[model samples]
Target chain A: MLDQQKVFYGILGLAVLATLGWGMSTAGPAGLAFAGAASFTIGGALMCLWERSIVRSAFSLMATFCGVGVLFILLGADFVGMAQILIYVGGILALLLFGVMLSPPDMTERKLVRVGGGLLTMGLGVAWVAGKVAATVKWAALPIDQLPEPKSHAEEIGVAFIHPEQYVVPFELAAVLLTVALVAAVYIARRKMSDFVPEVASQQENA
Target chain B: MLSNITTTAATTAAAAAPSENVVFHLLAEYVPEGVPGWILPIVTASISVGIVIALISVMAMGFTWLERKVSGHIQCRYGPMYAGGWHGWAQPIADGVKLLMKEDLIPIGADKALFMMAPAIVLGAIFGAFVAMPLAPDFYFADVNLGIFFILGMSSLTTIGVVMAGWSSNSKWSLYGAMREAAQVVAYEIPLGISLLVPLIVAGTFNLREASELQGDFYGMGWFVFKNPFMLPASILFFIAALAETKRAPFDLPEAESELVAGFLTEYSGIRWSFFFMEEYAAMYLMCLVASVFFFGGFESPFTYMAREQFGPNAFITNVVAASTLIVKSIAGIVLMMWVRWTLPRVRIDQVMTIGYKYLTPLALICVLGAACWEAIF
Candidate 1:
C-alpha cells in the first residue's frame, strides 16, 4: 500500500504541518492559526495539482505567500506583512507572469527532467532529520511578550539604514545589486532591440 | 498643565479600557454610560476613513478642475464654465459620467485578467499613500510612524501595475511604453529616495507629524525648506523627480500622443482610461502634499500663531487658518506642476534617461553632501 515516493512526500508534508502547528499555537489568537492551516492545506494540494500549466503553479505559490503574509500580520508585524505582499505578490508574481510569457508555447509537450528516486529519498530523509532537530530545539523558551510594540517598524528599518549596525551594509548591498540588475536588463534589452536594426536602417536610408 | 495630564490619562485609559469602563466613566460624567469598549475603536476608524476620503476627494476634484482651466488658458481656449454657478465647477462629474457610459472592449488576444487588474492596482497604490498624509493638527489616517517609507513602498507598486498592463495587452506600443515607464520610474526613485533622506536626516525621525512639528513655530517658514539653504534645492529636486516618476506632462512618455500613438493607453478606452486619469491626478496631488508636509511646514498657517498670540488660544480660528493655509500651499504646488506640464515640450526618451541618470542623480548627490555640510557648519 506504500509506494516509496508517496511515503517520502507524505513524511515531508507531515513534518511541515507539525512545525507549522507549533508556530501557530505560539502565534496567539489573531488569525495565525487560520493562515497556518490554509498554507499547509494549499501547499499539500499543490503537489496534487502540479500539472502542465505554469499559471496554475504560479497561483499556488501566490497562495503560499498570502499565508506567510497573514502569519506576519498575526505576529503584529504589519509592515512586514505589507512588504511580504508588495514584494512577493507584486514583484515576484509579475516576474513569474513574465516567465509564463517567455516559456515555449508547447509547455505541456516539453520533457522536463525529474530527480532520481534515490536522491528524492535522500533529500526527504535529510529534511526529516533537520525538522526533528529544529522541533527539539526549545525556541519557545525565549522571551517574546517583553518585545516592544512595533509602532513603526519601517521607521526603525530606515534609521537602521543610516546607523552603522544590523542593516546599513546590507542596505547598500541591496542598492548595488539593484543597480547591477538594472544595467544587465538595459544591456540585454538594447542588444535584443538592435538585432533587426540593419534592415530597418537600410530601408530608412533608401527612403 | 495639571488638567492636561488628567485629560491625556483619561483618553489613554478610555482607549485601552473596556467599553464598559469608558461608558460607565462617561455615564458618571453625564448620561447613562453603557457602551462597549470595542465600539470606540470601530467608531474612530470609520470616522477617520470617512473624513479622510471626503476631504481628499473634494481637494482632488478641485485640483483636477484647476489643472484643466490652467491648461485651457495656456492653450488659448476657454475651460470649464457654468458649473456650481461658477466656472465649470462640475465638469469633472460630467466627464466621469460620459466615460462611465462608454463601451468597454477587450481584445481577443489580450491577457484579460491582468488588463483588468492593472488600473485597479495603480489606483489602490496611489490611494494607499493618503493614509499617512496629515491635513491639520490631529487630522490624519492612522498616523503611521514610518510614514515616509510607507509612502515610498506603496508608490513603487505603480511601476509593477503599469508593467503588467503594458505586457498583458499584447500590443507593441503598450509594451514599449511600459518598458519606458518602468525604466523611468525606477531610475527616478533613487534620487527621490535620496532627496527625502536629506529631510529625514535633519528631522531625525521618519514620522511626518514629528518632522512637521520639529520645524519650529507656525507662521515662520521654519520648515526643513528654510532650515538649510541646500534643503530648498533638495526639495525642488525631489518635486521634479516626483513629476518624472509620476509620468506627468513633459515626462509622460508612457502615453506620449505625438510619438507612440497614445503609448500604453492606445488600447484602453472609456472608464478604463479614466481610471488611469484619476490615478495620475491623484498621484500629482499626493506628490505635492508630500512636498508640503516634508519640506514646507504642514498645516501651519502663516498668521495662525500671531493671531493666536493676539487673540489668545482660539481653537476655532487656529484650525480654520491652518486648514486654509495648508490648502493654499498644496494648491500652489499643484498649479506649479500644471504650469510646467503645459509650458514645456516632452523630452525625447533618450534625453529623459540622460537627464534622470546623468544630471538628476549627480545633482541629488551634491545636494545631499551640501545639506550635510550645511547642517555641520550652521
Candidate 2:
C-alpha cells in the first residue's frame, strides 16, 4: 500500500530514468549532460518526500548537492565545481549546522515543519530555473572528445583576480571590503570586552 | 618575449595531457592493435581505481606505523618491536586484524544511524583526495582541471563528518568538542586559503602541472621557498595555518586529550577511533603535499633538469625521486607538528581566537601585500 504522493514520484522516476538511459545510449559521454540534470531533479524529489526526518533529509540534500558538483565537473567548469563543493558543502552547510545547534532544541521539529512549505516552494522555483537553464543553454562549441583535467582552482581564481582585463578592480575592491569587514567585526566584538578590563591602582590614582 | 615563448612551449606537453585522459591513453596504448576502443578506457579506469585504492590503503597503514615509531622515539622507547620481526614493521597490519575482530559497541544514548554514517563520511572525504595527487609525471587517478581546489573542497568536507560524530554521540564532552573543533577549523581556513594564494599569484596559473613545470628550470636556488623573499614568510604562514587546519600542535584545541579526552572522538572506540586517526594523518600528509608543491619544487630535482634537457618518459623515475624529496620535506613538517604536540602548552580557547584573528590574519595580509610588491619590483 503506497501513498498517492509516492506513486506519483515513482512514476516520475521511471520517466526520468527512461529519458536518462536514452540520452546515455545516444550521447555516449556527452549525454552526461541530461544524466546530471536528472540527478538534481530526482534528488530534489526525494528531499520533498522526506518529511518525516530532518536529519535524513539534510544528508540526502548533501548527496544531491554533491551530485550537482559532479555535474559541474562533467561540464568542464572545474573551478565552478570546486567552488560549489567548497562554498555550499563547507561554508553554507556548516553555517546551517551551526544554526541547528544554536536553535532552541524543543522547537527543532516544529520549526522544520513550519518552514517546509516555504522551502519547498523556493526549491521548486530554483529547480524550474535549473531546468530552464539546462534546456536552453548551448555548449556546441565546447570540446566533446576530451575532458579537462583538474588544476588548482584557488590559484586560477586568485590569478584571475590579479588580471587587469578580467577582475583587477573588483579584486582590489574586495580586498578593501574584506579589510573593512575585519576591522568592523574586530571593533564590534572588542567593544563589549572593555568592561572586563581591570583598572590598575596606579592608573586609577593618575586618572 | 623569448622567455615567455619558451615558458609557454615548456608547459604545452605537460599541461595538455590531463591525468584522467592520460590514464585512458595509456590503457589504449597497451591494448593489442585490433582491440575494441571502449574496452581500453574501461580497463584503464578499473586499473586506475585499483591502484588508487591500494595506494591509499598502503599509505594509511604505513602512516600508522610511522606515527608509532615517531611517537615512540619522542618518548624515549622503541615501539612495536614484537609484532612481526624487524622494528615492528607489520604492527599496523596486526592492529588492523585485532580491531576487525573486536566487538563493535554502540552507546545507549547515541543516535545509531548518524553514529555509523559519520565515520564513513570522514573516511570517504579523506580517501577522495588520492584521485587528484600526481604520483609521478602522468600518474594520477583523475586530474580534474581544478585538482588542488578539489582537494581543499574535499578536505573541508571532513569537518561535517567530524561535527556529525561529535553531535550524534549525545554526550556533553562530545558536543563541546564538536563546537570547539568546528570553530577552530573555520577560523584557520581563512589564513590557509590566503597563504596558498601567495604561490598561485607568482605562478600565474592554477594548474599544478604548470606550476611544477615552471619550476623545472632553476638557475639559482630554484624552489619557490626561495623564489622570492616574500615566499619564505608566506610558506611559514602556510605551514602554521596547515597545523591549525589539521588540528595539530598548540592549534589542536579540539583533541586536547587532557581537556576533552580525545575531544569529539571521546566516545569512539576500536577501529572507529583509528578511522579518526587515519583521517587526521592523511590530512597532515595532504597539507604537507600542498606545502611542498607551493613552496618546494614538485617532482623537479635541483639540477637534474639542467643536466638533461631531452628527458622523456624515463624522466618519470627522476620525477618520482624528486617527489620523494617533497615527501621527506612534508614528513619533516609532520615531525615538527609532532614535536609541537609533545612540547608546547595548549592555549586557552579565547587566546586561540586572539592569535588567529589578531595576529595570523594581519600578518598573512601583510605578507600577501609584500609578496605582491616584491613581484612588481623584482
Against the hidden reference, what TM-scores do the models get?
A: 0.73, 0.80
**Number of backbone clashes in candidate 2:** 10
lDDT score for residue A21 of model 1:
66
Candidate 1 global CA lDDT score: 0.66
Please tell me which predicted candidate would have the highest DockQ against the true structure: 2
**Every model's DockQ, to 2 decimals?**
0.15, 0.28
Q: Write the per-residue lDDT of candidate 1 for residues B85-109, one digit (tens) a residue.
A: 5789898877777889999977787
Docking class of 1: incorrect
Kindly list the per-residue Cα lDDT of model 2 for residues A84-193, writing each as its tens digit: 77777777666566556433333133354656786688789989999998898786865554445634345566668879788999889999999899789878878465
| Pairs that collide, model 1 | B19-B36, B19-B37, B80-B88, B81-B88
TM-score of chain A of each: 0.60, 0.56
TM-score of chain B of 2: 0.87
